[model samples]
Target chain A: MAKPLILVTNDDGITAPGVRTLIHIMKKIGDVIVVAPDSPQSGMGHAITLDSTLYAEKLTIDEESEGIVEYSCSGTPADCVKLALQELMERKPDICVSGINHGSNSSINVIYSGTMSAAIEAGIEGIPAIGFSLCDYKWEADFSQAKEYVQTIVEQALQHGIPKGTVLNVNIPKLTKDELKGIKVCRQARANWKEKFDKRKNPMGKDYYWLTGEFELLDQGEDTDEWALANGYISVVPTQFDLTAHHAVQELNSWNF
Target chain B: MAKPLILVTNDDGITAPGVRTLIHIMKKIGDVIVVAPDSPQSGMGHAITLDSTLYAEKLTIDEESEGIVEYSCSGTPADCVKLALQELMERKPDICVSGINHGSNSSINVIYSGTMSAAIEAGIEGIPAIGFSLCDYKWEADFSQAKEYVQTIVEQALQHGIPKGTVLNVNIPKLTKDELKGIKVCRQARANWKEKFDKRKNPMGKDYYWLTGEFELLDQGEDTDEWALANGYISVVPTQFDLTAHHAVQELNSWNF
Candidate 1:
């Protein structure tokens, strides 16, 4: 049997520890190809470069990465996937995996996530996809602890293709492999950010602000992704790109326009 | 009764003709305050400025905008909403309206729309919101045809209040008011872009690419937003920021991971 081809990408730049670990893990399962942003695209959602030009350069990141194909792209996470599927790759990949991100993308973060955007982009193209993230946000955070679990999930996804019209958003808790219980499938938790912009002045007396926030959890559901991650389990949320609220369509139809 | 305070924004920047026209119409319905990006932010899906500082200036675009408070912010559409809700506005707005966008955000385009991002951001903040877009992509696109329909929807939304956990995404076809049919409550059409990157070389022999795509509609459903727009009717899809695929949860749970 021919080896299944896997496309690897992330919101963090290709040099980030998180994606480097992801590329290493994916290589064990199938033929590996990496096309990711040259800079971090943390909260870029599903953004694509329309008004600007994109550059993709093939490079060797390390001595061990000589045989693996990697392209550092000057675009968002979504743009990397689009360029790869449309132009870079010779044939369609069996699956696309994004992240092993430097931070959590659980609950409400999924909407603002560049990590999940790449996975969602591949899912839209009818390829099985998954986005993995660690609960830690530090650049030097431990990713070695997630190797076995990440590999298992990727193997399973390739074995049983993800359901159509959806991608997997996987978030791992900041716990040792021994302390980490296992994986659980859950729905996204309802939440929002309490944003506060830090106001400052420039030398010219111009007002500038830096955005900061605290995550506010609004749901108490045990079946939510938040609950799973909080309980030391890897949370796999089946995420979709379809923006429609199917349940509300009926009620809205009765209204006169 | 006191007039409702309406917040207006768009991805096409604060001064685009589409948003300018939106401000004029919204002013008639309520007290209008505008907070939009300082430059065009097309295809900027849900992006928020995290690693940089943002500058928001209280600017008056013209003499006609004297009394109405408007701020031009150096950020994405979602960032503008966050700034307005968190810092700029003195009080919580009654409703948030985005766009009268210059192009179609009818189906798959919704996932990549900065217009809808502002509305979704407001929705996450527990505010009733709606995003409006014209199927025409011209800067000088005739927005006069959408005046009556836009006002009716906004008024209806304020009176009835949108359902909890949802925002409205309305797309108007490129047609005169006479040729335009009425509004229709619809689901987002299932579609994808057949993206092709135009590759070229620079003087230094380095390659740069321009991204372009053609919309490919795959659904035959008559109740979709694409169907509505094609039939000369305005389409209103109840959009949600929650990315969870509820139906696929049970299936994923059965997987061994």
Candidate 2:
């Protein structure tokens, strides 16, 4: 049988070490074609470059890698998926995987995540997709700890297809291989950021400030992704792109619009 | 009873006429406080400024608008809401409304909309919220047609709050007052963009590309936001921030993670 075609992408740009690690893992399962942002697109969420133009070019970072085609995109991560599906690939990939991002995209952050947006874009197109993230925010975090675990999950996914209208958001804790426990399928933990801006003046004596915030976890449930990550286990949360509140629909209908 | 407090925000920068119009309309039904992005943050989605410092300051557009306080934040629309709740506002507003944006955020765009993100941010904080958009993408788009309709809807909302965990996403058609039809509450249409990248060469003889896309409407249902807007009727779709696919939970539970 022909190898499963896998589309790989990341919000951390094509040159990031995170995608390189993801590429190494995806290569063991299928033919890989990478289309990722040319620069870091953290916090971009599902932004597409409608007001601006986008560019894509084929490149080879490491020549020794085989059968892995890659293109760096001058657009957001979501734009890369659209370009790959529309213009780059001849046949649709069997699966699409985004990231192994430097920071976590679990819970509420998923809505603001470029990595998960790539996966959601694939799921919208009826393709099975997954997003991987590491809890550590450092550029050169140790992803070797998650190497075997990610490979196992991706292999299992390729062998057994995911359900319709659903994609996976997988986040791994920053732990050594020996300290790492097994994977846990869990729900997104309810969490939010406490925002505070650092006000400052520019060189021109004009007030110009920067945006900053800190994560604040509110949910303490054991079945949450936050709990799993805290317990040294890899967290796998099934994510959906449909923003419709099906449960709230009836209650909303009760209102006189 | 005192008038309901309505928090207003947008991604098209704090100075955009679209948000000004929203403030005007919302003020008639409720006390208004504007907390918006300092610069244009289109397509930011639910992005929060976690890695960087944020700033916000009391803005005084004019002395005539005295009772209504305004603050412009140096962050995404979501960050604006977070700051408003955490460090800016003394207490949670009764309702939150984002945009009267300069473009359409009707279908799949909602997932990537900074306008909707502000409203969703407010919703997650348990505040009733709504995101308003116009089909016109022009800076000088005629908003007179939507004034009466928008006011009516906001007044209705003030009288009867939206359901918990849900926010209204309203899209107005760009038509004259006479041509404008009444409001029609609807569901989000299943739609997507067909992306096209224009490849070109930069100054240094390096290739760069621009991202562009045309909207593709997959669902032709009459009770959809796209259809309503096309027919000159205001579209109101109840949107939710919960990214969880509860139906898929049982199915995923069977998977060997």
Candidate 3:
């Protein structure tokens, strides 16, 4: 029997405590390869480096894990996954896991998430993938609490396999292990950011704006990811890349084109 | 009757002929407001500006349209929409139309499309939206050929109202009006890019790579966007933001997490 080869990547850069904790857990499970951005790419969705050159460097991040390979990429999270699958890895990973991100990627945040984007990228390439996120967003946020839950989800994904044409977006509530309620497989909640621009003037007296927002949950559904997270449960939403609204196809066909 | 306020935007930057053509057509249909990126942002996907200050300035791209308001943003397509809705536009638009893009955003390409991202952003903001793209990628591609179809689709989308939870992903084949078959409502084809990294040594003797890929269509579905485009018809896929694979939620719940 061979250990499953796991590819690890994230949006919080290679040195973030979130990803570092993720790497530690993945090591205990299988062979690990870390190909992640060299800098933070927090809101970088599924962006690929189309107009620029990409640079990836082999780095020795974990000295103790003699078999673990790592690469630092000068691109977005999606780019890292592409570079890893096409150039860095000797073979396709058994599963690609992104994040343990410093903040949540549940609900509408998934649309702007670099963490989920990496996992989705792997899913597009026919690999089973999962994106893990902690509800806390601080640079020094404690990622240690979610380690046990993270390992269990990955193990279960490998055993039962993720549903085809989708990847898991697992967001753990920021709570102590004892306080955590457990895992909940849920649908993405309908919600969006109620954006507020913090207007400010630069030294040159030119007005510039900082994009900030508050999460506004629009759905009251109990089965939604937001509801699960609010109840102290780790939420797993099966996210898809095929953006088609299939239900609308029939109605659209009735329209006069 | 008050004119339908149509918000116009694209990934091809503010001055591209594709958007310019789109603006020309939109002016006839409604009170137009243009908020797009200052430079080409193709393949930027659903990215938003988080770590940087956003700068947007009023611009006069079309002088004759005295009532039309336009702003050029120093950010991604998604950011442009957020700025328009949050800061620039005085009122909520009746509809948001993105692109008249220089290239196709059908099938798997939608996963990496800044054009569709803008439309999807507007949809997330509770506006009826549509993203239009031409199959041609050349800068000077004849956007004029698709003008009639573009106008018709926008008009239809405005009247029909995009399905709840979805926007329209419209792709036009690069054909003269006479050659083009009628529009077809279709599903996104199951497809992905088979990535190839163009590795090279930079002038600094550092290894760099250019990401390239060939579109691999894995689906033989006749009702897919690819099929319609191949047959010289315009393709309209109702695109959703909820990303949740609803069918898979039940199966994932069966996992022992």
Candidate 4:
């Protein structure tokens, strides 16, 4: 039997250690193809390059590595997935995976995440997809501790198949393999960033602002992603692209229009 | 009685006729504050300017207008809302209304809409919010026909607070007042773009591609936004930001992790 085709991409650019680790692990499971952004697109959300031209080029990242195809695109994470699926790939991929991102995308952060956006884009195209991230947000953060658990989740997803209209947002707690707890399928924690603008003046003496924020978790539910991460467990939240608030539709219908 | 404070914004820039129309109508309803992008930011999704500094300046678009203050920001639509709530507004706004957008944001397009993203951002910030869009994409699309309906919806929303964790996505068909059947509160239609990359060679001999698509509606449900629009009715879909697929959690839990 032919090995399952796996498409790999990330928001942290092609050379990031996080995605490099993800590619290495995916190679153990299937034929791997990597199409990712040429630069960091950390908070790009689901943005597509509509007003500009997109350029994608084949790149040989690791000369010694065999049976791996890679390309980098001048666009957002979502754009990379769209370009790959609609133009690059000859056959539909068995599964698409995005990230081992440098930071967490467990709760409200998912709304602004380029990593999850790529996975969600694949899900929109009816592909089984997962986005993996670590709790740490450092350039040199270790991804080794996540390798075994990442393999486990990917293997399980391949076996059982992801639910329709949904994709997995897997955020691993930054801990040693021995210190890590098991995986927990959870809901997104109700949380938000308490935004604070760090005001500063540019060289021209004009006031400018830098967006900084503190994550404020509003839910203490044990079944939430935040709670699971705090308890040393990896959190897998099944994220969906259907933004309709179905419960609110009935009430809205009562309004006089 | 103190009038409701309505925060107005759009992705079509501050000078666009769509937003100008929105401001004109909103001024009749409440104290209006406009915080919109300085230039067109269509298809920006939920992006925020993290790697760059943000600048906002007070602008005098209509100096003769009373009870209205406007500012233009060098950021995405979501960033404008964040700045308004965090830095600009003296108090929490009673409600936020985005767009009078020059195009549609129904169905799957909501995921890629800067107009809806602003409304969703305000919702995340615990404010009642709505985003209005016209089906016509032309710059000079007539917004006069939408005035009465826009007023009705805003008045209704102000009277009955929006549902928690949700915002309103309102799309108007490009029709005269007499031609519009009515308004319909409905679910987002299941649909997707059939993407086609128009590959071309640049002047410098580099291969580039332009992303284009055709909307393909997969659902024939009469209770969907698409149906409402097709029948000459305005469509209102209650949009939410919590992307968790709650129903899929149980099934995913059954997987071996």
Candidate 5:
């Protein structure tokens, strides 16, 4: 039987250690193809390059790889997935995995995440997808501890299949292999960034602002991803792209329109 | 009684007719403050400018307006909202209204809409918010037909708050006011873009591509936003930022973790 075809991509540029680790792991499971951004796209949520042209080029990233190929695109994460599916790949990938991102995309951060947006784009195109993120946000963060769990989740997703119109947001807690607990399928915690803009002036004495914020978790529910991560467990939240608030439809219907 | 303080914004830039029309109508309803992008930010969904310094400057768009003020920001729509709320506004807005966008943001387009993302950002910040868009994509599309309806919706939303954690995605069909069949509360139709990349060669003899697509509606439900728009009615889909697929949690939990 042919090995399952796996598409690998990320928001943190092609050379980031996080995606390199993800590609390394996916190679052991199937034929791998990597199409990612040429530069970092950390907070580019679902953005597509509409006003500008896109450039993608084939390149070699690994020396010892046999069935692995890579391409880097000059666009957002969502753009990379769209380009790969429509122009690059000959057949639909069995699954697409994004990230092992340098920072967490566990809660409300998902809305601003380039990482999850790639996975969600694949999900929109009828491909099973997952986005993996680590709790640490360092250039040199250790990714070895996540290798076993990452392989396991991808293996399970390939076997069981993710539900239609949904993708997985898997966040690994920052912990050693022995200190790590198991995994938990959980809901997205209700949380937000309390945005505080640091106002400053440039050399010309003109006003400018730097967006800085603190993540504030509002949901204390044990079933939430926040809780699972805090308790040393990896969190897997089934994220969907259908934005309709289904429960509010009835109440809205009651409004005189 | 003091008028409601309405925060107005859009992805089509501060000078676009769509947002200018929105500001004109909103001024009749309240003391309006406009904080919008300096240039078009189409398709920049929920994106924020974290890696770059942001610049915002107060400007006068309408010389005759007394209580209306505007600011142009060098950031995404989501960043504009965050700046308005954190560093600009003296108090929380009574409500936030985004767009009067030059194109539709119905169905799956919501995932890639900067208009709706601005509204969603406000919703995440605990403010009642709504995003309005027309089916017409032309820069000079007539917004007059939407004025009365917009006023009514805003009045109603201010009177009866939107449900917590949800923002309204309102799309107006391209029809005369008399030809309209009123508004419909609906679910987001299942749909996706059938992407077709127009590959071309650049001046330097290098390959480049232009992203283009056609919307394919997969859902035949009569209660969907697509159905409402095609039938000459405005579609209002209550959109939420919490992306968790709650119904799928149980099924996913069945997997061995």
Candidate 6:
């Protein structure tokens, strides 16, 4: 049987330590191909390059390791998936995974996440996909502690394919392997960031602002992704791309058009 | 009674004819504040700025339009709404309006629209929001035909608030006022764009690709955005920020943790 072909991409630039760790771990499981943003696309949600052109380049970072087929793209995470499947990859990947991102994409933040967008893009194309993120935001954040858990989850997901119209949003708590609790399959927590801007002036003495926010978790449920991460466990929330409000449809149906 | 404060934003940049038209319509109804992107964001989706600092400045294209606060943001449409609500606006806006976008953001494109993202951001803030789009894609697309319909809809929306957790995804047909029918409240049409990449070599002999697609409608029902737009009627699909597949939730609940 042919080894499972795995496609890996991330919102962080191709050289980020996070994707490097993902590439190493994925090699142990299957044939891995890396197609990722040329620059950081952290909050780029489901954006695709429609109005502009996209550039891609084949690159080699190391000769010591079994060379992973890699391409750095000048597009959003979703664009990378489209390019990989449409232009680069010779065969469709058996499994597509995004991230091992340096920050969490759980709950409401998922709606503004580039990491999850890649996973969603793959899922839209009928491929089983997963997006993994660590709660830490530091550039040199430790990803090794989450590696073993990631391998276990990816192996299981590939073995038992994900359900149609669904992709996994796997967020690992930033903790040592021994300190980490086992994985918990959970639902997305109802939460949103309370946005607060940091207002400042530029060198020209003109007013400018930086978008910053404080995370405010309104939901106190124990089954939420926030709760799981808080308790030092990995959370796997099954996310879907359809934005339809099925329940609201009934109410909307009653409205006079 | 205090006049309702209308916050206007769009992905097509501050100078797009679509947004200028929106600004005009909104100004007539209420005190309008325009917080929009500095450059066209088109398919930028729900992206936010995280890796780099954001810059927003008070903009004045004409002295005639005074006292109405306007800011040009250096981020995605989602970032614009977040900034507007957090820093620019003195108080919570009564309503948020995004777009009169140059191209269609109906159906599946809603998942990949920066215009709709602005509306969704406003919805998350518990503010009534709507994103308007024109079926035409030209830079000079005439939005005059949409004025009366848009004004009526906005007036109605302000009079009767949108249901909680919902925003309006409104797409108008590109037609003269005489040619257009009335508005149709509908559901998102099940549709997708079959992507085609034009791969080419640059002067440096490096490969680059342009993203293009032909939209394919899979739904034949008249109660859909595509159907409404095709029939020369304004389409309003009440959208929601909660992306949970509630039906799948039951099956997911049955899964072993």
Q: C-alpha displacement of A23 in model 2, angstroms?
A: 0.5
Candidate 5 C-alpha lDDT tens digits along B1-257: 88999999999999899998888888889989999999999999889999999999999977655557789999999999999999889999999999999999999999999999999999999999999999999998999998988998898898888988899999999999899989999999999999999999999999999999999999999999999999999999999999999999989988876
Runs in model 2 with CA error above 4 Å?
A: A63-67, A198-214, B52-67, B178-181, B201-206, B220-222
By DockQ, is 1 or 4 better?
1
Each candidate structure's TM-score, on Cα atoms with residue i matched to residue i, is 0.99, 0.91, 0.98, 0.99, 0.99, 0.94
lDDT per residue as tens, model 5, A132-226? 99999998999999799999999999989998889999999999999899999999999999988999999999999999999999997999999
Model 3: per-residue Cα lDDT at residue B96: 94
DockQ of all predictions against the true structure, Cα-based: 0.90, 0.53, 0.89, 0.89, 0.89, 0.55
Question: Candidate 1, residues A94-211: lDDT per residue as tens digits?
Answer: 9999998999999999989999999999999999999999999999999998899999999999888898999999999999889999999999999999999999999999999999
| Model 6 residue B232 CA deviation in Å | 2.9
Tens-place lDDT digits, model 2, residues A145-238: 8999998888878777887778999999989999888898888898876665676777766665456668899888998899999999998888
What TM-score against the true chain A does chain A of each candidate get? 0.98, 0.97, 0.97, 0.98, 0.98, 0.97
**Which ten residues in a row are the worst by lDDT in model 2 chain B?**
B46-55
Q: Which regions in candidate 4 have their CA more than 4 angstroms from the true location?
A: B63-67
Better of 3 and 4 by DockQ: 4
Q: Candidate 6: list runs displaced more than 4 Å.
A: A63-65, A253-257, B62-67, B250-257
Poorly placed runs, candidate 1 (over 4 Å): none
Q: Please report, in order, the local distance difference test score of every candidate based on alpha carbons.
A: 0.94, 0.84, 0.93, 0.93, 0.94, 0.87
Worst 10 residues of 1 chain A by lDDT: A57-66
Q: Under CAPRI classification, how is model 5 graded?
A: high
Across residues A61-150, which tens digit of lDDT does each residue of candidate 6 receive? Answer: 555335789999999999999999989999999999998898998889889889999998898888999999999998899999988888
Model 1: what is its DockQ? 0.90
For model 2, give the RMSD to the true fold: 2.6
Per-residue lDDT tens digits of candidate 1, residues B1-257?
A: 78999999999998999999999999899999999999999999989998999999998887767799999999999999999998999999999999989999989999999999999999999999999999999999999988988999999998889988999999999998899989999999999999999999988999999999889999999999999999999999999888899999989878887
